[model samples]
Target: MPQKGSRLTPEQVGLIRAWIDQGLQWEEGATFAKAPVLNLSPRRPELPGDEGGHSVDRILASYFARYGVKTSRVGFWIDFLLDACISTRLACCRQ
Candidate 1:
């Protein structure tokens, strides 16, 4: 589908004109499907009863531990990380 603020393609314009030429079929309750829902908030799974740590810390620790990832929290990634944090209200880089 064409994006908002974007001009309709020639094909789309033609289709609309054709529909108008056809007297515009009327169908009650005929509508496009609703857009998918978005959850802007962060979601942290409920930890086990014995787990001890903030959800953010736990998530990062688990990721690094499982994947054996290595890297200082410094460099270009940190810049992108900060931007994501700001945009997501600290959800992405909370830990």
Candidate 2:
């Protein structure tokens, strides 16, 4: 009594799980490198306007004014720096 154009039910999901458990090896190799690792510094913090409508710049400015340390490249500095690191030629497993 299967309905046409219906979503997968719990039993069907369990069957899929069983199939995966029985040696359903997924293809791997080079697909995992798409996302970049965020090696963030302690100086950078979770900014305001971060999906909660908080102003990141204002918060950073206030913090900088308090500590008297100028905030440079508030938003894009991390990404730009990380991108450079990725593109640079470094030693890779010289063994």
Judge candidate 2 against the unseen true structure and give its global Cα lDDT, from 0 to 1.
0.66
Best by lDDT: 1
What is candidate 1's lDDT per residue for 1-95, written digit by digit as tens? 64768898899999999999999886997768897799889975776435564444445665776799774442445578778878898565675
Highest TM-score against the true fold, candidate = 1
lDDT of each: 0.70, 0.66
Q: Would you list the clashing residue pairs of candidate 1?
A: none
Error of 2 at 90 (Å): 9.4
> Tens-digit lDDT track for model 2 on 1-95?
56878789899999889988988765676364668779775776566544432254556766777799875556566577767776663534332
Model 1 / residue 66 / CA error / Å? 1.7
* lDDT (Cα, 0-100) at 7 in candidate 2: 83
The estimated TM-scores of all candidates read: 0.33, 0.26
